[model samples]
Target: MLQDLEAKALAGDAEAQALVHLLRLLRRKAYQEARAYAEGFPGELRERLLAGLSLLEEAPDRLEDPLFAAEREVLLGVRAVGEGRREEAEARFQRALALDPYHHRALTNLGNLYLERGEVEAALDLYQRALKLAPDDPLVHENLAALYRKKGDLDRMVAHLKRATRLKMRPPVSLDPLTGKPKRSFRIPLWVWVSLLALLAYLFLKKP
Candidate 1:
């Protein structure tokens, strides 16, 4: 489960950070906040996330298909961003959304670009729209939470974080700077899983 969550996180699951945030809150005995966060997940968005995970994971397989023109454009946009071609990247992302209004990842990357430029309102708009299009997307949720946090809105931040935590609540790992490998595996014993589940129920369901 740990490995699975790490794979999803490293693959850019936005909500991966939410799980990390939840764990941090839990460790700090911020039970009220954690519960508040988790309660938000029992909604339409949770259903979407549960349903769409497989589709997102398999999406890259279609990159080579002719029908995935918009997806290809998103990749180009991402590459452009990495190359520091800001204008080009923005244009590529915009072109992708023009081709497919529901292009989830493209919206996310574009939102991120806006956020980096300190365009909070534009970034928020894009991120919210992105979440609506891909509610189960971890990265979108995480980004939204970050935006909220930046705005000093802890409640909203925790709400989105909870949504992300529901996606893959596993211990995060640190990479070895030299080898680019995980420094340690979060190997939990079966008994711990059972106990953890019980604790989760208490933490999330027992009203604060």
Candidate 2:
């Protein structure tokens, strides 16, 4: 149903577009819930959620839209990032930034790429640029905090973490409430659980 709706949406069906939007929202919610519940090995869930997010980030483009080309480039860059093609992703992001210097998402992702590559100063510069454009973006703050943490700069880490928490984007997950050991299960919205269970049931019932 999602694939069919996506096809119709791409073909310019308004109703299909709405359905696609709804499905995308549900998918995002489910991904968030799963991420929240993810335990020791978080890399897998993080990658999965990021991949889904990158795809959804590209879904807003209309064929003739003026921003379509830029969006496509950004999406391609994001895919390259996912594939461990850092240089390719960096080039694509640079091109996208050239097209729109104030593109906050491109800036933020570029900063994160730099951070991953151990280019702390470059990452800081890019992140600062992004923050100048979107000071309230909690993801940027969180990424910056991670960089600070890596550098052993606890003060800056705490500052950025505080900003991220203020933005309400970071889920309050930590050690166990009782023993201070890492916890596995985290709270998620009831609707997300319902949707996930429903989807699982549907898949099970449809199995051959």
Candidate 3:
């Protein structure tokens, strides 16, 4: 069945190609999906799928494809940041940004690294850049709010917190109330709950 689908996909059938690409993504075989779609898809769909694949941090091998090399470089930068190699990570991120200025992951990671290193201004700049590129990224709003809080800019922090809260709570038009269903409610990460509790505690303490 799968082989038949692949054959059909390779025969310029867009729907089959899209299905194959989706299956590959679900299997976590993103690089292969990108390669297949790049090889089989016509033009715009191919470009979009390849771009989506490049965003996956796991697809380093896909860097060999010229279209994805810049994304791969950004992923390497993020890896360096994770390993505590700040300078190398920053350099790599800069290179990636030079190649694609609106790379959201690279911008966010660079902002976070700068924040960690106490370069608050630089971090804010990077976060702003990221926001321009990916306005709906909750993490970016969260981080920016954190920065403003640390800087004692209460008004800006509160504004950003409101934006983050709205962003976090926007729901799909329909949701599944049952478990083991095709549609389900999004799970809030544990850290968000923890932060909420902390905020409540601070408010309670201040009420006295």
Candidate 4:
């Protein structure tokens, strides 16, 4: 879907270009930047994007707009999560999914809610569905990694953790949260270093 958006944007679709840029910022969790960029557009588009960004603000009130019903539900769901209203949050996320099954954040957040309750299988299913929609979502990968670790699947955990780390631009050699083992970086063999040193020393002596 993102690829399609980018292709359309490149083909001189101004609306597609604007939406693509907005999505890029949103994917990075840059709400402020996305809002500012969205503001540059006019009319309905600006109103809709601004309304969606409002969900990320310090204290957001529910905004009613049929055009953004799904996003509005997601915002309410997130607020419910923060307020310790887990049931309410779940319902909101579910409603958002009913409105738009492809809503990636809704799927991820609902999965998180399930994971918190030790509903591992359900959470795994939701996370996988969310990943199908947004493959580059670092948060989904991180959560999925945690889920895998909880299931005692260390290899899969490490794989997803590494992918999440790379997506978030973190140091590659991070410590394993489960085993306290840091991933080792490759080093030159001792024999190679010794041979290089010996060759350099011989060259210097010959030059003298």
**Per-candidate TM vs. native?**
0.50, 0.51, 0.56, 0.64
Q: Report, for every candidate in turn, its global Cα lDDT versus the true structure.
A: 0.67, 0.65, 0.69, 0.77
Residues 1-208 of candidate 4: C-alpha lDDT, one tens digit per residue = 5556678989999778777656645534556666667767789777877876775564345555443566667778988999999999999999978876777889989999999999999999999999998888888899889999999999999999999888879633443322223557789999999999999999999994
User: Which candidate order results from sorting by lDDT in descending order?
Assistant: 4, 3, 1, 2
- How well is each residue in 100-159 modelled by candidate 1, as lDDT tens digits? 676678888999999999999999999989888778667888999999988899999999
Model 3 weakest lDDT span, ten residues long: 172-181
Per-residue alpha-carbon lDDT of model 2 for 101-141, expressed as tens digits?
Answer: 65667887888888887999999999899888778778788
How good is model 4 by TM-score?
0.64
Write candidate 3's Cα lDDT for 1-208 as tens digits: 4556678989987667665545433222235534554545557765765565755555664556544545667777877878888899889878767765656667877888888879999999998988886787677788899999889999999888899889879862331212112364589999999999999999999995
Model 4 scores what on Cα lDDT?
0.77
**What's the lDDT for residue 82 in model 3?**
82
RMSD to native, candidate 4:
9.9
Report clash pairs, candidate 1.
13-139, 14-138, 14-139, 15-138, 15-139, 49-136
Q: What is the C-alpha RMSD of each candidate to the true structure, in Å?
A: 17.4, 16.7, 15.2, 9.9
Model 4 pairs in collision? none
